[model samples]
Target: MDDQQFRQLLNRFGFSWSGYRKVRKGVKKRITKHMNALGCYNITTYLAELDKSDEVRKKCELLLTVSISRFFRDREFWKSLEKKYLPDLIDKNIEKINVWSAGCACGDEVYSFKIVWDCLRNSLGHLPKLEVIATDINPVYLEKACAGIYSSSSLKEVTEELQSTYFIKKKGKKRFEVNALLKKDVIWKTHHLLSDPPESKFDIIFLRNNVLTYYEDLLKKKAFRKILDSLAPYGFLIIGSHESLPFEPKDLIAIAPHSFVFRKEAE
Candidate 1:
């Protein structure tokens, strides 16, 4: 597609200019692949032909770029959560523990957190129903996540001891599946973080490596505001180690190294 057409197409999908810029190379490839999938070679012609087809739209959604994720992608954050964060939170008498894993591509992070939460619950001798709502804009990824299947590499971060306890190796080559216990805790759904409102206030919102780097300052601000607004009074906001807020406020406390968990001050 021509640059103008590409710009308009991304804008239609709520892609900010900065977001588009960051992913332009990937988008070009996606558009090219999309056209090929539709049996066309030219993007300009492809857009014109598919403009009226919702089927094309769905295919295009599948073609959008994404990076692969492995379980326990960041080990230190998981460690901190286990050693420090979870203990404090479990002491509370909350009725439900809601964790919203936004941009939860392929459910690795969702499953990882679920594993930790289950371990904590078992250790404490009481298990509260964990309502973990895993969301991503892409339907394809969500489908894969709900299936609870993974390649062997997804468990690379898990130590042999934990892996033995949490995963059962399948008969096929390069295959494994989550133990039935962890499978019970997660609910996967398609959600557009850019446009949709927070479905519920959460005790923890795990929005890692994906959000901040893609958008421009204005869009980033908008996302940060959405995240802040989505959190419960004492909810924690855990982001990737490479990410940080543009401006720090007293309400957002840096509890562990490189982890900023926000809590609304008690009135």
Candidate 2:
């Protein structure tokens, strides 16, 4: 598929052209294969198939998805999460801390958070319970996440100490699997961020590198509002380090030392 055909597909899904432009070549290759499978010779026929068949459209959306993540992506953010934010939440004396790793592709960020939480137990005894809801739009990714195995490259950002503590290397393989201990109590589900949140407030919601990165303004703003609303008062909303909020929200305050970390204003 050429750029024009790719743009048509992005428009059909309300996806951002700029967002897909950089990665469209790979995405188009996948879509083109899908089109050939359906015997669609051109964009027009593929578009028609998408319109009439819910199954085809769903598959197409999965093709359009871009999941490029690693453990402890953006080192500063994880440092802040561990040294500052998690500690502050602990000091609040809340008995339970709820976390939502939205668009949690392949569970890297979710497991990374769990590892940090586990580390805190070493320094601070008797910490509150952590409830993590990890969601992604693609069930295929969720399935892999459930398996808790990751490529060596995905663990590049992880320190040697962390690697020794949390992951067990597969025998003679470059991949590592998260310890079963870290996988427990994580809720993994297939979810579209454009829809309502998981019917629960969050102490910290990791909304990094998906919606704000790949959606058009209208969809981005709408989804951003939903994510914001689901954050409990004073709860944190962490976006991609390079991403900007679609609009200046009145109730969100940027945390010091990091522009990407925002705390919901107390109601």
RMSD of 1: 3.4
* Clash count per candidate: 0, 0
Candidate 2 per-residue lDDT, tens place, 56-144, comes to 99999999999899999999889888899989878877889999999999999999999989988887877888899999999999999
Structural similarity to truth (TM-score) of each candidate = 0.82, 0.98
Residue 218 lDDT (model 1): 62
Query: Least lDDT summed over 10 consecutive residues: which range in candidate 2?
Result: 19-28
Q: Name the candidate that leads on lDDT.
A: 2
Which candidate leads in TM-score? 2
Q: Model 1 reaches what TM-score against the true structure?
A: 0.82
Candidate 2 backbone overlaps, count: 0
Q: lDDT of model 1 at residue 122?
A: 70
